[model samples]
Target: MTFRAKQSVRRFILGTAALACACAGTLSAAAAPANLAYDKPAPTINPKLTALSKAMQPKVYKVSNRVYVAVGYGDANSTMVIGDDGLIIIDTTESLTSGRAVEAEFRKISKLPVKGIIYTHHHMDHLGGAAAFVQPQDAMSGKVTVISQADTMKLLASSETAKANPLFTRDIMTARFAYMFGAYLPKGPEGVVNNGTGPAMVAGPVGLVPPNKLVDDTLDVTIAGVRLHIVRTPGETDDAISVWMPDLKMLATGDLLMGETFPNLYTLRGAEIRNPITWYRSIDRVRAFPAEYLVLSHGRPALGRDKVASVLTNHRDAIQYVHDQAVRLMNKGYGPDELAAAISQLPPHLRDDPYLAQFYGSVSSSVRQLYASYFGWFEGDPTTLNLLPPKDRAQRNLALMGGEAHVVAEAQKALAARDYRWVADMLTDVIRVNPSNMNARKLKAQALRQLGYAEVNANARNWYLTSAQELEGAPLQIQNDWFRGVASPQARVAQFNAMPGRAIIGLFAPRLQAERTLDVHKTLAFVLSDSGDQAGIEIRRGIAEVYTQAPPSPDFTVSTTKAALARLAAGDTTLAHLIESNAATVQGDRQGAETFMSYFDPPLKDWSDLHFTTR
Candidate 1:
């Protein structure tokens, strides 16, 4: 089998022997028969995971004289293209701190002014740290060109912007993201070794500067004497784009071909169903580029044409194989779970390639997602349409299994017999019936820990272990650091203040206290003195209807800057204080304006209680 990395760089790759060693150390001990067990080794986390994670160690990979990629400086790789008299930055890392770190390294490479900034997609990992690279004023004035797909901002409105703040689902998505990335787990063997795509998410001030130049299909442009081809390839994201430097023969692929691991056909963290067909076709387009070097946003770069071609082919073929095989089984009357069971592994050729490793994406999960995408959640089973609630079902199951005590006893025996899956399944009922039951929680945590220790997929391992920690109420350093540092109330207030005035007012609709406003009929118009953006809200019946246009006859009008509004929402100040201090002015009834402000819920005091496995 051809390794993805060259022999000299092979140490960067995780060997099959490491995985075998990990299984031999822990899983083998768990499976040993009681009668045959003379001496069992102590349980330990997977060493393969630890070895695989080292690929994210901070280092500047020199692709060529003109291009350099800083990997592991942050969760996402940042590339600096050294052009004559200037520079172009492609995909800033996840946070300002990380971007600064990468910028410092690039300063060592060249001190030329940044002529342009390119975002491959709208993901925070790619664009959030943009502020660290170029000044906002320079980008706005076109002194530095900001290029991206035309649909990037439109897509951002739904997820990354304040428009998403109106939807309660964003909160759940944030919590899931934290869990999927193991954001709260320590960077060690027992916790998170590394993020599947990169190191780990860097939590800090996330900034965004809207693109000035948008790519429709393909654009041929010259920046600082470097001619480049930017092609729109809808793969991992609908707005995904790939950059090809014709002169240098270097292709910079964003998350399209994510790291050395198999492409995440469907991430565990919630996202729109990524079409596998589109993803493979997109790879085919990039395959046409006769690139000598492949610089990726997640993993190490490939140095030769043959090496790059081989890796690209195997990666796309793996995605197509998973898609076709799953659909084939689905046509044969296989359900979601059945399809996952049927297509357990790839073909030997593709399976043997190191690029197709399941370190990030799992065959089972992708297969299940395929089923969901095509057929919805229903599997032609009527019973699933109106099934009993989980709590009620658990209560009934406990009743049938004698009692909670008997169920716990059976789960204990299953754990002893090395049947961790069954133990977890059985204990879910006990936990549901009695959340405070320490015996059930502890046993479930133990089962999950063992399962996590033996799992090679980093995402699944992190999820399992994090869930266990939640059940046991264990403290994590990342959680504390997040709340105290970048994610603090003051920090969030500043973030909100920096958002568009329209977005700040849009959040009002979702935070309205519907019960209190049901009988109240009032209208309030907001005019941002700083940005000159105006929006209005009318409380009628049970809804707070928001409009960009001015209201016909607002009971009162509050004129203030977006910053003051953010502070008011965060409970840092009050409407009365704003009026008294001349920070805001009321054009109409002052009493009505205060009443209008009182109708919305205040910002959350603490987000630490948002757990993945808990209610």
Candidate 2:
């Protein structure tokens, strides 16, 4: 091995050991002052605004004589419509515990049997708690019909499955979730004030029941004697749908149009860029309806004919305004960040309009997403195509900036001037170079805390504060063992099962030792005996090609159950153990098969636990 490679490995090992030690007792070792002045919320925050934000609480709103919505039960809302024969529910809170709370409260208003459930989209918060409303057995037996877009299962499963690239890890995703949801925030005014979606999330296992019926397009149907027109609204997700109750003149728009806040065309937690044109088209359809009342998934119901129309129009106008202006600038050759900065705020007339508040989605993320949707990520800059990786860039930048001390000193000056954003950017490189710098860590925490406190957007605040807690060396339990602690084994296995088999095999290429395998040519045939699905793989010079079946000549064939194979692939078990347990059998050459497994490395990648994650 070269000198630099060996030194890198040693540095990695040492850094990991230091992180473990920090996670164990750093908080006490680097305790903050008994009353850290900067720990308080920013002095500029409006008192009235904070109180109004805290007023978000769980309650049932009667939208009409027949329709009611359970608001703020968790980070989502559930709407129930009572019919002559039974009841129909639209959306459910985030988890089973939260769903049960809303269900109990809903029973206070009506005791009618649940006849059907309508999921607006493929988001977990919108439908993860379906089981709390109705038993799975009932849905499976056709007692209660569950309906969603036909692509719901495929889209939902794709989201939950493992990433094909190691650069995108679940820990990073979970870490982003922690930031977006304020998982690390304390339960009080000082932290976790409100998630724009609702009051807060409830702790419990997520309950999911797959849809039994599918809605492919515009369908006019009746459930439990309630006349409804379901429109496929492709905005937040491809499987998004909206229900319009013609009889009652009520339109139930799920997260399609959120509460007194700007719609999130792009989420910081990472998601596909929402198509602005499609979203505007969907809003226009809702505007065409003469709805007297509207049920939302996060905020209070919009009542009265004129009031609902005005609200819907304002939202539509804002969406179109951003899209139109953004596209015009892109035509003039403005890149994403430039366009984002230019369109920092809405027009004055619409800025303070109740529906256009920057509570959930900010203009920065929106402009970027819209620009990408229209022009794609390439900015016509050739240098960016061959950009340096993060670590290398950080090292070079820090070296040019006269090392960590110079940057930290400048950050201290920025902190003194109350410029939190500058402080964050200034200290980022220093921390990346050496995360063990206690001084830099604490300063960065203070900057993030102040920024989070002063921010108006819920997601931005949650991320800033959560990141602050991390720099202060706060340890998260789930951050340690994500799969075992965050979700059940069955759920994890189901995600793996839903992933395309080709994607599963493609993940192996990055782990192959091309240097060792440059001269070694080998072929392994994988056959799922139970499912009768087979894939033949040939690896040469670290390149892998997969076929529908085993080649005419293969060195060995490994026939096994998908379950055993998934377990081994997940690093949960070993191939030798599977062979010994009779779950797998190797024919032709057992030694060659075992050697093949060794040729390709298992995933052993991890990033720094500090706040600056790649996600």
Candidate 3:
């Protein structure tokens, strides 16, 4: 069978399995009573809205008397708002197929047109259905108004880099399926929830329609006669926004307020460290609202003023608890590792709150993030300040641990003792020393699974499970159907030029041996046709690479639109294919062409064999 045919079959099977599991009472109901084993008390329900899906799916509910929120397997949450003129949506679930299934719920409510869309954040589960909402032009046109924070635009625009991270957003997509979706949350077997059910799917290169109106602090607008109070919050992303309706006393807190789980201070996908202080403050800002009902971008809604206040209070306190503890240690001059160990214990109040659980994010990782954000990677020790390369450090550590076997054995002991953090560390060394260590891989997977199951933070759980999945085998590939015909060629060139010089250096590192050094002094520029945004980058070593707007004749002139670049970055096609197809062109130095290819460091090709532990 063709790849597409096989994928279709896989998706069908997975969807069928999910439907069966959801119908079998394996998934918990979103509005189950608090006293019930799986049901948490419904937070204050918005008086303006009534819950639908009473006959369709027990876990699915609706608001605005038009919008439908479906709680699916993996704790996956989707929202459909039917506006007076049309429908305005928030999140789109994990896949187009799943998103359509969500849309069907909306159909059951009302068949209003989908007029506008808002991506709470950039996570795939939330924003994967751009194509499903409307045609590409419709999304880009002012009629649809695909709104998001400016930072979210930056993230979506740099889709290539986001996908390139070691822990790609694909992992986030699947992990959400296993952990948050209804299959495991209310009550299910401890480790039976698996995220790897569907074929690989990547969102199309999204046409980043910046919010026509940018709100630094807050912005109030009415959609379909319903007033939405949008507020900026730096939680999962530096540019995160939450929507509220004072009239309804309802708040749609994008990723900021998951039903039960601590937020991920340190995400697995590599990025700048997030500030716990800022996260707490953002939650505090939301709590100031007279919100009676709370709906998270993920998980179920909280109904009632008291319940909403309670969840918000716990969420704020949980973040503050971590921040306060980390700050206390930092004041004592404790390093990242020290702070991580020191703040492992949570105060009983914070620990007992279901909202503060570590289902996604962990205390240890958050502590490390606090240190990294405040003091960077440098520790006080000079020897550690300027560290050896990763591979060298792994080799040295392996030798010190009496070679690979001994290191693996120690890792196993750590795993048995439930020392997952330590097991992860030891396995890192073993994997570095010997990348193909199957035993190390298995141990790493086990450690990650333990971490995933224990996490209260949804993002953290996803990260751990994703890591474990990578260890076991290649993750299913996400089809890049979304980007196929939507990218702009000029935008691709601009994006390539705008990539951070440090990232470019890292990408090229594999091909750049220590013995060979090239000092190419030159500046390059590219002007995007679509947005008319011009970006110029200077190439220099040691000195910081500068970005500007005055166009310069680059050493090599490569011409390709942003759409083509998106396809290349998404692994839809190769750089060579673009050149051969006349979609992309390069001029100037032939040697420069070769040099550029050297810099494109392919990410770890195998996702499944990423062993988590040394043992």
Top-scoring candidate (TM-score): 2
Tell me the spans in candidate 1 whose CA falls farther than 4 Å from its real position.
1-43, 84-86, 103-116, 128-146, 151-168, 202-212, 475-486, 498-502, 511-524, 553-559, 568-603
lDDT of each: 0.75, 0.71, 0.56
- Arranged by TM-score with the best first, the candidates are 2, 1, 3
Q: Against the correct fold, how does model 2 do in TM-score?
A: 0.83
- TM-score of every candidate: 0.82, 0.83, 0.66
Q: Rank the candidates by lDDT, best first.
A: 1, 2, 3
RMSD to the hidden true structure, all candidates: 10.8, 9.6, 10.1
- List clash counts for every candidate, in order: 0, 0, 54
lDDT string, candidate 2, 1-615, tens digits: 233322322332233222222221121201211111112233534342364354455568899999999876666789999999898999986566667777877788889999999988876678867777998789878889888887776566543232344223554665566677665666455566666756655544456666677788887878899998998887777678889999999999887787778888899877666777888788888888899999988778889999899888888888889988988898899998899889989998778787778888788788898777777889998988999986788889989989888889988999999998888887887777787887888998899888877887878877787777778777743422212223333333444444444444544556677777887788888888755667767887767666666565788888887656655555556678888889899987787888887776654322125355211
Task: Give stretches of model 2 more than 4 Å off.
Answer: 1-55, 158-171, 189-191, 375-403, 472-476, 479-490, 498-517, 599-615
Those runs of model 3 whose alpha carbons end farther than 4 Å from true positions after fitting are: 1-58, 62-68, 73-76, 80-88, 111-116, 130-146, 159-216, 382-515, 519-615
lDDT against true structure, model 2: 0.71
